[model samples]
Target: MAEERLIIPKKISNRFLMMIGLGLVLLVAGIVLMMIAGPAHHDAHGAAAATGHHATTWYERFLANLWLNNVYFTGIAIVGVFFTAVQYVAYAGWSVLIKRVLEGLGYYLPVGGVIMLLVFLLPIIFTGHNPLFHWTDHSLYEIDGPNYDPIIAGKSGFLNIPFYTIRLVLYFASWIFFAWWLRKQSVAEDLNGGLTFYDKSIRISAMFLVVFGVTSSLSAWDWVLSIDTHWFSTMFGWYVFASWFITGLAATTLTVIILKQNGYLKMVNANHLHDLGKFTFAFSIFWTYIWFSQFMLIWYANMPEEVTYFRERMGGYEDHYTWILFTNLFVNFVFPFLVLMTRDAKRQMIMLKLVCVVVLFGHWLDFYLMIMPGTLRGDSGFGLIELGTALTFLGIFLNRFTKGLTEASLVPVNHPFLEESIHHHV
Candidate 1:
């Protein structure tokens, strides 16, 4: 079979842009409402001001959910580069057919990194509102102050504003640098068609994996886990990593399937879908393993500090977030485990797509559970902030990923394994 260039239809392109427009409208609207909802003000007693009005409650929830979606989407993009790097390092041939899709998805990291820096970090540090990071309230570090938090202060050396800001910058800079370099070399290979860039990619990928292994975990610690400063979990890093990686896999798989359905990537077929399905399935279980391990150990230990995390999540909310819990576990774990367990299921385009969608939303809820408990406590409920923020990032991702596809040949023109990928079959 001969390989041909993939062309995205104008209809699809228009649709993507329209979605982006809608997402922007929603994001702006959500932001306005959040502003109206008001900044979180803690009373002298260290308790959040009793904003008796529902709108004020909406503001806090919106901020938390917005931050959650931003971090979640960023995680997906970061793992996009990680996935591609791993495939390069492993010399994997089967994925060469869909490498462009993965690369396009990876392009959104810089966008997300900027959002985190400008929206989340700058505000926490300069504004000193400290709504997001309680540690940002200098009063907490005061030895005898009403807002004193000895635990957070104990970890102050590492969690201070200056060090935290520097690490955030370094992490994004490193990730963006590696992702840019990898794609640059790959695109150069498409034109030069030699082992020069290919060999370079392998070496960079090897180095990237090592750096990524550490940075990815630390980013999770800083970005997500730190929300509940008192709660600590040794497994938290790996658990979140599994969630982000699997979600990235599902996003990649879905994009590939969508392209194939639209009559592009003619060389890709059931074998490719099956491999993607396997990843989705395998990692869904891996996510479950980490989830259960984290929960079970905390439950077994029954220590006040450790159990506080689950206690807040289970008991903090007015409605008890029990359903979200079930949804996260069932959709992310059980559905994928059962639906994609069969070989035929993995090959079926419809099933694979369905499972991918499930995994994506399930992990979104997972991040929600992780965040809301600490920030909004029992007040967190899914509303415009959740819906609009999700749409906003979803639009940003589609627009960016699609734009990336247009900039390059949808196929890696000079990949040594291109032939093997073309002939790949189960």
Candidate 2:
């Protein structure tokens, strides 16, 4: 049998282009808004400085911090796509139907890298306040003052500007290389039908997984945990991994459903959906286990530093914290566990779609809980900025994912396990 010819529809490409264009515009607008606001804030503070009454606007602080957090959180999502692709490659499954979706996500790795690099370089570009990370305050390292955090001072040797920049470069390189390699193998398999590409990918994936494990842990610590330098959790790395692992799975499942619904992926049947649903179900449990383990350990130990992290989250932001716990457990754990426990539910499109949506939102809330506490505490309002940033990323992600799907064959025609996948059962 001849191989299926891949063709991306013009409409899909155009839509993707529109989404990218819109996202770019929003990003530019956000930057401009901040730039203008920065000077006005400085002017206001300057006037107050003369009278020895420093006036700082809450709105200005909120916007600045919100932008910083958005950049970091989005980086997590971008890294997530690469993690998902690595898993698929390692498993060597007949996931050709979703390969393009993963590839589309891979495209963001470079863009994400650039965003992170820029965020890290902000202190250098502009002598602005370090709302997101306080370590950027060089004066703290120079003087042993009351305002200086001892913990940050202790880690200064490793966390200094030069080392931080070097680590960031290494992380981006590894991700870009892993994404490129995996995609290259998949594309190569299309031209050369055999297990050679498969074997190579498996080896590469194994190596990449080890690298991913270490890099992901350090990345989480550097980007999120370091914001609150006084606190540390051994479970933090595993916690981050669980969250993003499920996030990647949820994203993959959602992308597949969208394609199937739109008549783009006819070859992907109920069987594939069942497999994806099982993964979604399994990971939901995995994420819950990690969440519980982290929380229980810290709660039980009652160590001041360790416990303070949760205290800030639970006490300071009681409402958001409680809602987050409920959503994480009910939507991510309870609903999926019960629904996907059955053989029939896994194959049911409507049920699976519903669960998938919940899982996606659940993970989004997971990221929110993880990030917001450390960054924005007092008034973490769900305002236009949060909504706009999320919508912008979603629009861009969907556009790229769908267009990438159309570029590759919906089914891996020459894959060794293609038949097994097509006829797979619970």
Candidate 3:
């Protein structure tokens, strides 16, 4: 069978404009709320005075929202490249049909990397405040000062600004290089047929995987785990990888469905969709196992330092955020486990799409739980600010992905395994 080449749609519809408009409105609203709430925070005095009372304000919550979202989107982008690279390493044939979609999803990496770096730096430059990360307080390292913290001071060698910034640069630079290199080789392969580009890609992909395995963990530790300066978890990195991996699976599944509905990816059939569904189902369970292991080990040890992480979410502010744990587990694990357990349900496009959407939001809430509780404290509440900010990022994600799709053949015609992917079946 001759492969049909993909054609980019000449123009995006008015619905695309509607998406942009809605994103702008939500973004503006979120920014307005954050600006208005700015005065409530006492940056000069920090979250606590010399008297040792913990206080939080709405601006801090806004900062928390920004930080959480930056990492969330970054994870999504990283996992996109991760999904593609893993397939390349394994010489997987079934995924070649929708590989372009994965590449498109990865275009968000450079964009999101810049945004996250700026968000991390904003407090230090403009306000002389570090609301998201309290370790930025130099006084904490001063042994004689009122703000002295023995724990934070001890970790300063690894957690200092210079090293942190360097790692940030290296992580983004490395991921961007791999993403760009792979995409370039893929398009080049189309122009000049043969396995020359394909052979280079395999070697590059192997190197990328080794680097990603290490940096993904380091990045997770730097960005999210450091939020609570006192707590530590050896399992934190793998746990984070699982969350975004499953979430990325859902997003990829949804994108394929959308493309097929619009008369693209015609080669992808029920069998392909079923395979995607199985990944979603299996990873959901894998994520749950990691989630439980992390929680259970900490709970059993009963150490104040480690247990405080959960304690804050459970008892702090009357359990405002505790319910998120249940919701995350239900939507991500239980919902998929029960719904997609049967063979028939895996091939049902509508049900799979719905579950994918649900799992995406569920993991967003999972990240929210991880970051928000550390900074928001008594001020923690889910409202327009949080919802609108998420909407803004979602719009950005979609806009970039759609624009990226237009740049390449929607199907990689020269890929050696295209035929296998086209005729893929259980």
Candidate 4:
């Protein structure tokens, strides 16, 4: 089994590569559709637009969708490393067999970093305008300039491009470095077969947790929260993390199930699935708690500043967001809670996959609500651009992820937990 896994079956590896071709075709088709449809397409969604913000154009809508996926998938990729760090520091044995899966997922960090950088940097380079983050527009800080905004200018110290870029680079560099170091140590442990690598990994994991705890929140602020420019939430960072964690958990769980269905991870079984299921179920509630807490606090206070975020989504973008808002709650919270409630259900692959797919797409909509309302200024346009961008990201992510799986032996033979994991019973 170890010998076989050392080289992934072509069946699985090629399957993901095929997604790349399919994704490219769809992406090109989408762009062509946009060009033919012209800017008039989005004007219909004007169909409606917000009062205080600039009108959204078609390509800007394309860029907004691009940025949306960048943040959404980046979180899923980072949480892979976060999950691995938690298992190591907590001395978790049950996850040993699936650690490679987590690592494979984390491998996307470097690529995701590049995509995020492009989304942020390209518009500024070509047009000197920040299509995504309104605060990033330099004119907003031009004290005497007509476009000057005192509120946005006040945030200039932290939101300035140089500082923001530095933080963005800092986050990806830190995440990528730890992800590489941990994977290196894991492979080393597999070769040497000893406690030395394991002990070293725990120390590395502890350091990483500290780094991640700080960066996760700050990155969320820089990437998502800053988009609003005016609204702030004390729990926004945590809210983003919760959403990222569950989406990653679902992706990880779904990958394991897929691998098992394809005859990989022979050592993993129902007990492991249950554990993953419990993680998905618990975090759904946790995310709902964060969602409600953020909402309730704002709604209760009805303060203009804090309430503006929700107001923009519910009151202003109500036409497009209303159904999506309810769907987000049902799929992310209500569905997961009730469906995964039974012990047997958690152990069942069919049920887990259903919930995982729903959670994955549900949170994408969650991020859509976060980004589109602000960027499009109430004109919510969902079409080929959104679908195409998402498909391209999905294909690229899966391709990178599956290729990583082939790099290491799926089973961590030298792991101290290997024996226990093989016999692991819930």
Per-residue lDDT of model 3, residues 68-174, tens digit only: 77788778778888888899999999999888888888888888888878877777788764788878878899999999999999999998877887899899999
Kindly give the number of clashing pairs for every candidate: 1, 0, 0, 2
Off by over 4 Å in 3: 1-21, 30-55
For all predicted structures, in order, the TM-scores are: 0.92, 0.83, 0.92, 0.95
lDDT of 4 by residue, 1-426 (tens): 253274556875676667666666766776676567665455233455446556556668778888898898889889989999999999999999889989988878899899888888888899997788888777888889999999998888898888988999999999999999999999898898889999999999999999999999999999889999989999999999999999999999999998899888877899999999999999999999999999999999999999878766675654666667788899999999999999999999999999999999999999998888788776666666676778778878887787778888889889888888888898
lDDT of 2 by residue, 42-146 (tens): 321122122222333444344444444444444445544555446556574546556666666666566667767776677555774455666777767765565
For model 4, the local distance difference test gives: 0.86
Best by TM-score: 4
Global Cα RMSD, each model: 4.0, 5.2, 3.8, 1.9
Q: Report the Cα lDDT for candidate 1.
A: 0.82
Q: Candidate 3, clashing residue pairs?
A: none
- Report the lDDT of model 1 for residue 91: 93
What TM-score would you give candidate 4 relative to the actual structure?
0.95
Better of 1 and 4 by lDDT: 4
Q: Which stretches of candidate 4 lie over 4 Å from their true place?
A: 1-15, 43-46, 50-54
Q: Whole-model Cα lDDT per candidate?
A: 0.82, 0.67, 0.82, 0.86
The best candidate in terms of lDDT: 4
**How well does candidate 4 match the true structure, expressed as C-alpha RMSD?**
1.9
| Superposition error at 236 for model 4 (Å) | 0.6
